[model samples]
Target: MDSHVFQAVAAAAAALLLFLTYHSLAFVAGKKLPKGTRLPPGPPGKPFVGNLFDIPPEHSWLKFKQWSDLYGPLFRLNIAGRENYVVSSEKIANDLLRERGNLYSSREQLPAAAELLGDNLRPLFLPYGSLWRRTRKLMHQLTMPSAATTYQPTQVLESTRLLDDLIRAPQDYQKWFARYSSSVIFRLGFGKTMQDEDVLRRIMDVNHSLERVASPGSYLVDTFPSLMHLPDALAPFKRELKQLHEAELGLFRELLDDVKKQMDQNVAPHCWERTFIEQQESYDLTTDQGAYVIGTLFEAGSGTTTAALQSFVLAMVHHPEWMSKIQQEVDEVVGTSRLPEFEDMPSLPTVRAVIKETMRWRPVTAGGLPHQLVKDDVYNGFFLPAGTNIHPNQWAIHREPSLYPDPEVFNPDRWLDPSFPTFKEPLTVHPNIQNYSCFGFGRRICPGQNIAERSLNILVARIAWACDISKAKDEHGNYVDVPLYDYVSGFNTHPKPFQFYLKARSPHHAIIVRSALEKETQSDPLAGK
Candidate 1:
C-alpha cells in the first residue's frame, strides 16, 4: 500500500493500456463504411487513447450525460479504440435495443465477470444465443409475473423480521435490508433461511465481488482482452478471479447437494433448485449448470434488491415531503390496525410511485450493462459497424430532461400527478417499474425483474405502513445530513454508509411488528410443507 509506488504502477499501466488501444482501434474501425453513412458524432478524443483521459475517475455517467447534452442524445464515446455508443434518449434506446434487438442482443466479452468469475454461465454475462436463451427461458418461467406471485408469501414472511429489525436495530438498517434480500433469495433458491452468519457473509461477499468485478474497467483485460490469454502459471492477475469463481460455484454446488440429500429423504422443500434438479434433463443441463442457474438467480436478486431497498430509505430520508405523502396515501388505504399486504398494492398508487421514482432517482446500475452488435447497422445515416459496444446508459436514460423535468429533484409527482409529462392514466397500470429502462431493454431485460418488483412492493408498503424513517439525530438532538450521491460505484450500486433513523409509527405498530416475528415458524403457510 505504498502510495508513491502504487501511483507509479497505475500510471505505467495506463500508458500501456493506451498504447495497445490505438492498435485495437485500427483493427475495429479500419473496416469500410456503408455508402453515404458515417458514425454518430461525439466529443473529440485525442489521437491514441481517444476519450480515455476525458472520462473522470468516478461517476462517468455524469460525463456521458454531459456529452449527450453537447452531442446529440445518440452519440458515441471512443475510449482508447473502442466504439461505445451511448443512447441517452429513451426513444433511441428503445429503437436500437428494443425494436432492432436481433442484431444488438449480443454482449462484448467481459474478462472478469463473464469469463473469469462465471465461466460465461451466469445469465447476466451470457451472450445472446442458445445457452443464453435456454437459461433466460428457465428463469423467466420461474420469475414471470404469475410465477412471481408464488413467492409473495416468502417475501411477506421474511419482511416480518425486516420490520422487527427496523424497530429494534434501526441503526443497522442497511444490514437488515441486506439480510432480508439475501434471506429471501436463499429461501427461494435453497429452501433455507440465511441464519448462519458465516454463510450469509460469504453470499454477501460473493455478490459484492460480482458487482465490483462486473464493472467496466475493473480489469485491464477487459480493455485489452489479450491479457486473458496468458498462461495459467504466469497469470497472477487471475488468481483472485479463479478463486472467486470456484468459491461461488462451490457454494452453489454445496447448496444444491444439500437439496438433493433432502430430496432423497423426501423432505426437500419446494425451491428453484429442486425444480431445476427435477427438470434438468428436459432442459439439457448438467448437474453443475443446474446449480449455476439457481445460483445466478440468487446472485441477481440479492444485492440489487438490497440496493433498491437502501435507495428507498435514502429517498425517504432525503425527501421527507414525498415520504409524508406516501405515508398519508398508505394510511388512507390500509388503516392503522395491521401491516399492509400485497392485496393493498393496487390501491397504494403513491407508494408505488415513490418506489418507481426512487429507482429512477438513483439507478443501481448507473453505468448500465454493455450490449454488443452482432452485425453492421445504420440508424439515421449513422453507420454503426458490427462489434460496436452500445450502452443504453441507465443513468443517462433515466435522466432524459425531456421525459423527467427537473430530473435532479426527487419528485414522485412526476409519476403520480396527472399534469406531469411522465405520468400515465389508470394509476393501477402506469407507473410500473418492471418495464423501466433501469431493469434493461430488449431480450436482456432482468429475469429477476418480477421478483425484485414484488420484493420492493411488499417491503416498501410494509415499512411505510409500520414505521417512519428520517434523518438520524445526535445526542444534542441535531439532525444529520444524508448525501444524495454517496453511492457505491460499479454496475450494481447502493448508498455508502450514512446515518438514518427508523421507528414504529406508534406502540401499536411496534406490537404488530414484534408479534409478526413471534409467529415466524407457522406464520408462513409455505413453511414445513
Candidate 2:
C-alpha cells in the first residue's frame, strides 16, 4: 500500500534505508507531468527504500518534529514508494485536512489493522465513502457534544468510584483509571459494566495487537502492498492476522448477542447499543457492521481515556506545583461536602487547563492518525499530489512555540494566562479539546471527543480534590524519578509504568469519597448533575 507512516521495520537492521530515493523521486509524485509545481521540501532518502532507516520504529514523532524544525512544518518523506507528508503546523493541517476535507478526509488502507485484524469494517480505518458516512450518521445522535451530556450520570458515578479506587489502591491506579474509562464507555455502548475478567483481557489484548500492527511499518505487507498480493501460504502475516481477526470479531459478536438478549427480555439498561440494534435495518448496516461500529466506540473511549488520565498523573509527578494550585481551586469550588460534579467544571479553570495540558503535553495519538489526500492540491504555492499521506504531527503541532511557550515544560498557565498565544478571550471556550489536532483534523476527527473530555474532566478534578499525587519512594525511602517523556511506543502511546504516590489529602477527604460512592450506588445512578 502507498502508506501513511514510518517504515519502522527497516530501522531495525541492515534493512532498507530511505535516503537513496530523494535525488530523483522526492517531490514529483511518480512524475505525472506536474513540471512546474514542486512538492513540499523533505529530507533526502535512499533509493527504493525511501527514508525507511531514517524513520525510527518508535517515537517517530520526534524525528518528524526535527524535520519539521528544519523544513518549516510542511515536509515530505517517501518510504518504499509511499508518499508521506508530515504537516507540523496546525494552520497547514486545517487548510488541507479540514478546509479541503472533500479531497483529504480518506485514510490509507492499513493492510494489517484495517484489513486482516479488522476485516476492513472498522470505521476508524475506513476511507471516506458510503460505509463511513453511514456509520458516522448512525452515531451522530449519540456522540455529539450535546448528546454526551446524557451520560454524565454514569460518568459522575464512575468518576466517584475512580476516586475510591485511587484512595484504596494507589499502586494500581492505572488499572482503576482503565476500569473507570472502560465502565463508562461499556455502559454507554452495551448497558453493562466491564466486570468479566476474560472479556477485559481479550479487549486489552486486541488493543495492544492493533497498536503494534497498525503502526506504519510494523508489518512488511503494510509497507509494501505487493507483498499482500501473494498467497496466504507465502504471506504469514496474513494467515496469523486472520486468526487474530476471528478472535476479535468473535468478541464483538459475543457482546452484541448479550445486548440483543437483554433487549429481547426488556432487561437491558439504557445504552446506545439498544438504540442502534433496534434501528439497524434503517441504518442499513449488516449485523457485523453494527457490531464493528459499537465495538470501535468502546475501544476508542477506553484506551484513550486511560492514556490521558495516566498522563495527568505523570504531569503531576513532573510538576507538582500545578497540582497544588488545582487542588486549591477544586477545594474552594467543590468543597468537602460532596464529590465534584460536571457543573463545577465551569468554575474550575485550573482543572480544565490541566486536562487540556495533559492532552497537549502527551497526546494519546502521538503521531496523529494519517489522512490520505484524494486529489492534487497546492498550498502556499507548494504542490501536494494526490495519494499523498498527511500526518498532522500532534507532538510537533502542540509544541509550536508561537502557541505554547516553553513547550517542554508541563505548564497549565499557557491556557489561562492571556499573554500566551493559545489563550482565548473566554476561559470557558478556549481550552476545549473538541477540535484539537490531538483528537484529529476535520471530518476525520474523533466523534467521541466530547465524552472523552468529560471523563477526563471529572476524574482529574476528583483526583485533584481528594488525593495528592507525588513521586514514589523506593524501599529505602528515596524519591523515584519518573521520566518526563518516556512512553510505550505504539499508535496510541502512553506513559510507561511509573512509580507514584497517591493518597487522600486528608482523612475527611477519604470519608467524602466513600460517602459519595455509597450515596451514588444507593440512589439513582442516572440522576441529574
Candidate 3:
C-alpha cells in the first residue's frame, strides 16, 4: 500500500474512534443522572426528537388525557432530547404543586417567553425567586382582603354599566362582558371609567396579540428552540416575533408612561399604578418592575374576569332555572328595593353556589400554565427529571369522575350542602369538595383571588337579580344552542361570541333600573329637574 493511503486511513480511524468515545461518555453521563427511573412507562418515541412530532401542537390537553389514561397519573414524555412529566391526577398535582411547591415553582425554559417579555412581566411567569417575591408583595398589599373593600364602590359602578349595556343590547353581551371587565381593571389600575372610550377594543387588541403569541404552536421556533439560534436570513420567525415583541412593549410602555406622568404630577388617581408608584422607593421597584406589576394586574383582571362573566352568562342562558333560583335568593336577602351588595354575598348561598358551578363547568384557563422543574424530584416512587416541563391539566383534574361525579353537568347543588365547604377552605374541612383549581394552587396561585371573587360574585348576583336570562333565537325563531365546549383557543379559554335573550325579571326590576339611572341624572349638574 502507498504511504499516503495508509496515512489517510489512520486519520479516518482516529476520527471514528473519537466519535465513539464521545458517544460513550454522553451515554454514561445520561445514565448517571436521573431524568426518570428506567423501565417507567412512556409512549414509544423516535430517537433524538423523542415524541416531538407525535403530539399535536394545539389541544395538547387532549393528548395529556390520552397519555395519562394509558400511563397512569405520573408518566414520562420526551421532547427533543429532553424529558417531561405530564401530571394528570389531582393527588399528584397537589403533592407537587402544593405539598412540595418550593422545588416545583420555577418555569420551563421558554425562549419566546424569555425573549419577548423578559423578566419584566407578571409574577406568574417570573422564576421562583426575589422578582416574584417583590411583585407579589406589591400586588398582595393592594389586592388583599382589606384593600379589596376600598375598591368595592368602583366594582359596583362598573358592574352597573355592565347591566346597562346588557339591557340596551343583549346581542353584544360578549363585548359588554369584556368591556365591563376591562373597565373595572381600568378603573382600578388607571382610576378612570371607560365611558364610550373603547376600553374593550383596546383590551381586545392587546389580548388578541397576546393570544396569538401564547399559542404553543403559534411559532414553530418554540417547538424547535435550536432553530432560534439560526441566522435571521434563515429564520424569518425571529423577525416576526421581534416585531410582535416590540409592539407589545410599546403598548405596555405607553400605558406605563401615562401612569408615570400621573405620579410625577402627584395628582394620580386612586389606582394600583398610583399605589405602586407612590411607594416605588420603599418597595424597591424600578420602572420595569412597576410596569410589569401594573401590566400583570391588568392582564389578570381583564381576561379572567371576562371569562368568568362569560361562563356566568352561559350558565344563566343554559340553565335559566339556576338564574331564577339565584334571583329568588337575591330578592329574599337583599330584596328588589336595592341592588345586592358585597356584604350580602355570605348570606346568599345560592348565588355563591352558582359562581362555584360556573367556575367548575368552564374554567378560564382549561389547561393551567406550564410549570418546569428546577431539580430532579421523586414523587410516589416515580422520578421527574430536572428541566422536565410539567402541567397540571386543570380540565382533566376538574373532570375526574372520582373527584366530581357527573362533572359534565352544570349543578350548583354540589356546592350547597350544610357540610359542603368553600374552595377557600382546605380539604380537611370537607374532602368531598376540594378547592376548585379555578384560581390554581400552591405559591403560584393567583394573587387577585380575593378581588376576582368579589368582582365575580357581585356581578353575577346583580345579573341574576335584574335579568331573566334565556337563549336567543335565529331569524326562523329556532332555539339557538351553545356548545358547552365551544371556546376560543388561547392561553385563556373563553366562549366565542354568542347571543342570549335577556329581559328585566319584572316591571319592578325595570322601574328600579330606570330609577337608578334617573338618580344618576339628578346628581349630574347638567341635568334639569
User: How does residue 125 of candidate 3 score in lDDT?
Assistant: 69
- lDDT (10s digit) by residue, model 2, range 368-412: 999999988888867777888999999999999888889988888
Reference-based TM-score of each model:
0.94, 0.93, 0.86
Clashes of 2: 13
lDDT of each structure?
A: 0.84, 0.85, 0.72
User: Of 2 and 3, which scores higher on lDDT?
Assistant: 2
Name the candidate that leads on TM-score.
1
Indicate the residue-level lDDT of 124 in model 2: 89
Candidate 3 lDDT, 326-410, residue by residue in tens: 9888889888797787888767777877887888788787778877788777775666666667778777777677766787889
Off by over 4 Å in 2: 1-36, 524-529
**lDDT value for model 2:** 0.85
How does candidate 2 fare on TM-score? Answer: 0.93
Worst 10 residues of 1 by lDDT: 520-529
